[model samples]
Target: MKIPSIVFALLFTSFSYSQNISGKAYYESKTTVDMDNFGRRDMTEDMKKQIKERMKSFLEKTYILTFNGNESIYSEDEKLEAGDNGRGFGMMMSSFSAGDQYKNLETNQLIEEREFFGKQFLVKDTITNLRWEVGKESKQIGQYLVIKATAYKQVDPNDVSMMRRRRDRDNEEKNEAEKKEDTTKVEDPFEDLEIPKEVLVTAWFTPQIPVKNGPGEYAGLPGLILELNVDRTTILCSKIIINPKEAEAIQPPSKGEEVSREEYNKIVKEKTDEMRENFRNGGGRRGGGGRRFGG
Candidate 1:
């Protein structure tokens, strides 16, 4: 006996919905270190060149976001690979709404719309504005409907460098000029930098969750972004857990760097340089001082 067409369709739909959506989100942020008057004053042309070369040699980093609503909990696993320090991995769990807020977990403070690579990203922001051009593509992510959309934005390298240098100089001046230091004051490093005006970035997002949120600085989509790629890295939503059986509360991460995205990048760069220098001076074991994967 042949099955009815409607029954077959229903079965196919049910099977599709039963499959959980899971994927990895990859991001490649390109940054240029300029030695011009706007950038690092102490950096020589050769040093800048070396820095650029080092950055170019970096491998892509991976972050995993699992969403299963049925479980009533949420968790995230981030694996950072490459660099001289080897491999490092971190696991974080929180209430489903944990990533939705800017909270401090461990030493890492969550921030929102922090600028990195000359563009603004919505990390843990209550409000965000992300604009993208509509495209003609549709794909299925689990049981939910998905549409592919693209957006283009320019990134300014000059702004990043200048902002970094200004922050550095300001910090130094403050440290030396103040007779009485007020360590309680919180400083925003990107205050002096203007919005970026060069270098175009394109991104793809899917609107299924009906929320304008995504990993990093991506937002403003009509739905949840399942897959995103720009600057040569790709981020795809592999699995989503909605309303899980037992409801594991998704807690925010406890250990990760917390700063404006730009500040974070600067810190990473400085740390990398320090490690490299230590290795060169034989003060650290070879390949041991730098960032290691799965740390």
Candidate 2:
């Protein structure tokens, strides 16, 4: 008679979790600005430095997570009243920003508001619950004990959307041409272009929180997620406010063109392609795009 490895591991991690835990979790999210990824080859050294400065305002950001039981709303805490983190030029910088996301584990639903080219989209779809491989290893995050979990997420390898990176005008025009396919044939509305996907996600959750929720699209753990590391971006929880005096109403975003995730992605692709066309033909400065939220 012998105890299996999995059973022993589970028994070792069976710490007494907390009870009646509910509250707000403050997470600080930071992203790196990859200059080469922005597709600016002809940019001078001075120009590159300037672009980094402007993008810095967005790369380092703060987000708030409000959760009670298995429901949560994750959104950016832009400190709008403070005004662009005192970066006066942020108002004139880029026009598009990511939207807030809300998820409900009880209903298996998700409602996210994504902003693209100044247009808002209500992305209504069921939550993509990732299959996580839990490990026996454990570590202490603050007062709670957390175990490791790993998952793989399919992502566009050439996706420059994160942090709203720049795309070259010529490349976009070339892509559009490729869509035309046969030169002698009529243009095709769609192309069979295949996008590569590559991304690995690592998350650590604390059983003490005891909720299957986390920041952004991450959830489905036996506990609360305290840290999420995806690619070059890091979203870490800095503080947990349990049972706040007042809780904000947790509701899905109602405004914007109601559409599914796939539909919204299509809309974004079309709008972005059009923007590149204008830029290639020297249509002047872009007019659309603004902060995701304004205080």
Candidate 3:
């Protein structure tokens, strides 16, 4: 008995749809700390470890993307936990795409445009406040197309309390005659306060996928972003599932502060500087103890 041409075509389509490709995304990124204008401070072994851990945390945070004619969903899960207790901080981000059941529920949503990295680009209105910028180049990730993008991290220079600490120290140096007897030190409440300059990042995206989205505040690519690099850290797409055997179910996250990509960078820089200050002042326990303990 011969099958009808329509029936054969249906079977072929089903077979093609059933095929699921899986693989791991390997990323090698360089990280540098701007210590002085002369050059960048190389990342120490401990610093590298910390960066990897941070990337692991970022991946643990979820971001979503959608494509046209695809009812499927894509996501990544960071397999690492918080803290520095061994277990190696690593991540595995995956994507799922398939039938209408798996399609994005908000595909009709409008794409919003904002200025990022000195360029006009598109992003989702839900996350319009986040800063984004264009990158300098492009590359391929598996079968998907990818382009590079950049974003800035800003720093706030007006943290008054930190400045007060500096004034307290200056007052200690004044001679008795130079210092007014009745005058209380009016501390300049902005010393010791540092704001990080805007940092540039490069990311890889594929415009054909039709989603201007990525992890953290980085977005506004012509296509779905597959990989990104900011400063020295990186985030990459590991696996994608288009048309899973099971029903596709994806729930986009609504938690997290919505800041422009620039604002986001500023926050990170401020916190990082604060932490480094704490470490330098011997206020917090240093990681690895700088080789004193054979770390």
Off by over 4 Å in 2: 1-20, 35-49, 79-93, 156-160, 163-196, 283-295
- Superposed Cα deviation of residue 99, candidate 3 (Å): 28
Off by over 4 Å in 3: 1-136, 151-195, 245-247, 252-295
Query: Is 1 or 3 the stronger prediction by TM-score?
Result: 1
Give all candidates' CA lDDT scores: 0.40, 0.67, 0.39
- lDDT for 238 in candidate 3 is 60
TM-score of 3: 0.39
| Per-residue lDDT of model 2, residues 211-250, tens digit only | 7789998998777899998876889889899877786678
Model 1: per-residue Cα lDDT over 64-174, one tens digit each: 443321111122344333244321110000000112233222223345333232233334322224356655566566565566656555553422231222324556445
Error of 2 at 11 (Å): 10
lDDT computed for candidate 3 = 0.39
- Candidate 3 lDDT by residue in tens digits, 1-295: 2223433343454443323321222333233332221111344667655554554543334333332332223333333344443311121111101111122323523222322222233333333223555444556689865655555544335321111112123434343334356344332212333334544566666544444444444445444557876544566666554433553344333333334434543543454445445444543344523222111
Steric clashes per prediction: 52, 2, 27
* Candidate 3 RMSD computed on C-alpha atoms after optimal superposition onto the true structure: 15.5
Order of candidate numbers by lDDT, starting with the best: 2, 1, 3
